[model samples]
Target: MSKKNKNALGGARQILDMNAFDAGAEATERNPLLERRLANVGAATVLFYKEPLEIVSASGSWMTAADGKRYLDFYNNVPSVGHTHPRVVAAVTDQIARLNINTRYLNSVVDLYLDALKATFPAPLSNVVLSCSGSEANDLAVRIAAAASGGTGIIVSENAYHGNTSIISEISPSALKRGNLPDHVVTVPAPSHPGQSGSIENAFAADVKRAIAELERRGHKFSAFVCDSIFSSDGVYADPPGFLRKAISEVRKAGGLYIADEVQPGFARTGDAFWGFARHDVTPDIVTMGKPMGNGFPMAGLVTRPELLERFCEDTGYFSTFGGNPVAAAAGMAVLDVIADEQLQSNALRQGNHIQERLRDLATKDDRIADVRGAGLFLGIELSQPGEKDQPNAELASSVINGLKDRGVLIGAAGRFGNTLKVRPPLSLSQDEADIFVDRLADALAASA
Candidate 1:
């Protein structure tokens, strides 16, 4: 780590114990929202939906909650670059102080922004349409996919979660709003170990083939096969991108589109490549992005082949008041620049290697930690029973998460049973910070045992 990173890590370490002095009766009373939020989350039995002690501010890879407590943040995959990164903040601020408006008129920021973004994708997938969030981008993707394929059925992973919009929710098996049992949606199991032995890549391809075959048997036309290329919710599986090649080929043969949802795993969080789909060595028909693209400035977009999007334009126009405006473009541009200039992608590669090594060692020591899987920055620590077939233990997972929070580190959990601890920190996290995080996580694991 550089001297700057060393100092920043030291500063975060210093504030870890500050909450000890005042995290008491007065603090709880003053923030009634913090207290009541847990009750609401508990009433619903929702996973990690509570207010979470009201973090007052955040910068880089650390967040300072209400009680003057600072915690190392390893859960915010959306802050792809970093929290309140000075360059991104300045870019947005400078643009807003000058001029920011719709795309009805030509703007340098929007044009320059699109140019930089287009360089990240394959040549055929060059055009871009911006939106304010991943949900909105996914919504636009649905319109484009439906238009391009002339089909209504969409295929997704069994526990996949695309977004919260009605169309996305219908396809996302994780959505509890309407039970996610939509008529036009086809769900298939995601690729993971400990389930089937022979090449999970083959299993994924078979699943896609089976889904398409079933759709054909039922005389149903499929619009698209949508998947998070990294599949964060399906236990952070990032192997065998070539595994989906046959499935995608089948989808295309069936006149369906292949949509890679990169909302949580975009912008080089997966390391090795800018888009998670690139890791698979397959170019997607349509790609949706959000979360880290703006580094928390509410900017996202759908990029696709001009030919694919043209079908939608022929029918109805897609427009959002806040999409691709100057401010959003500026933030997005800054994030891209930081990823290149700061070499944050390389940093994610190195730090993720370190984290994975440590976690793997921990898993060997304790059989409860079923597995550790993911590609750079995005990771999942699976919790299971002792010497058993990695069954989901949601209770133990929650205990470890709350325990880590108490120790001044934050992480997110996903998977169908909410039993995997998702550890996707900011891409800018340093080696020193990684050490602190690993130490604390080990402490949490010991406490759980």
Candidate 2:
């Protein structure tokens, strides 16, 4: 949509580059912390905003900067249960104080957490392998799929971002700042945004069929079709429930597994279901989840059919030093407890619908907001040129993001074109907070305009 926005989506996932600090730009302020941070992290530093907020602490849906300014936290993919949730914090603190050992030990907390977690999954996905991050979970899931299916080819959405590990990065087209995808990886278009009338179920399934054929021709036997149920990196496409059924059916017909990477959409974030894939009513052969499992604790994992794990372990065993530890298990259990005890899933649905209605009302008044679509708290606001709804306006999206920041609200961008504002507030977000976001977004749009 732009020669100017070429840098936004050309390489490196837009989530990384969008609204990222321009290290090359001249700074008018002399900040000691910024200088020290840059010196420490060097080129690897990925700070948000040109002027980067110095966040010192966070709680619930707000983050406090070093300057004592509080900003609504909407951009972070982690902290799904909310930043610094007390239950998760207390659970981790207490468990670590008593015992924090690897899963090799027979810890009741670990078993209790596993049993409770497994109960949430479909019956066949009874086995769970714990890891330290979503990337690790995805890496293991892919290997399991390949081992079980006896193939190497994997299909993903064009801009899908599963994780940062070698295997996952190869399939994550958005992660690459340069170079083509590996031969074993193939990509299909994301499901269309809601409100675009068509048989979306069939269109997406057809694309998977094409990807499968291409992989076959490349000598990479189709092993799996992997994607986050919400397609978070593909601009958060969540609509027309059950659209994934046909695609998974096609993958199964070709003897390929359907791997659901739920790092972003699981843990009641989608509101309607315990797992994002459940909203589509399709059972994933392998499900990879992280980010929100232990709230902020470093714990992630994959659940799959017992046979898949059994087959994989025959070749090589798997273990993570800190994964499934008593402390992590405690945190995990607390997160699960909070979700159930607080009725957060129902709250997510209510608030999400509330915000969506407000955004749609704004869309009527402002043509720049091309569309407002997504489920629960995982919403996307697509920006376009006024009177030209299809024309992506990344510059506008960036401007609005910064503008929102200045207005004390925080958000991020997504989409292949980097024109969609990712409105990912915490599932525990209240109606009052929801209104603040929408009201400020309108102000930001007007100010940016």
Q: Would you give me the overall lDDT of model 2?
A: 0.89
Local accuracy of candidate 1 as per-residue lDDT tens digits, 41-135: 55433223233456789999999977899999998887778899999999999999999888887899999999999998999998999988899
Clashing pairs in 2: 12-176, 12-177
lDDT of each: 0.81, 0.89
Model 2 weakest 10-residue run by lDDT = 5-14
RMSD of each: 8.8, 2.2
Q: Give me the runs in candidate 2 sitting further than 4 Å from their true place.
A: 1-13, 193-198
Number of the top-ranking candidate, with TM-score as the measure: 2
TM-score of 2: 0.96
Best by lDDT: 2
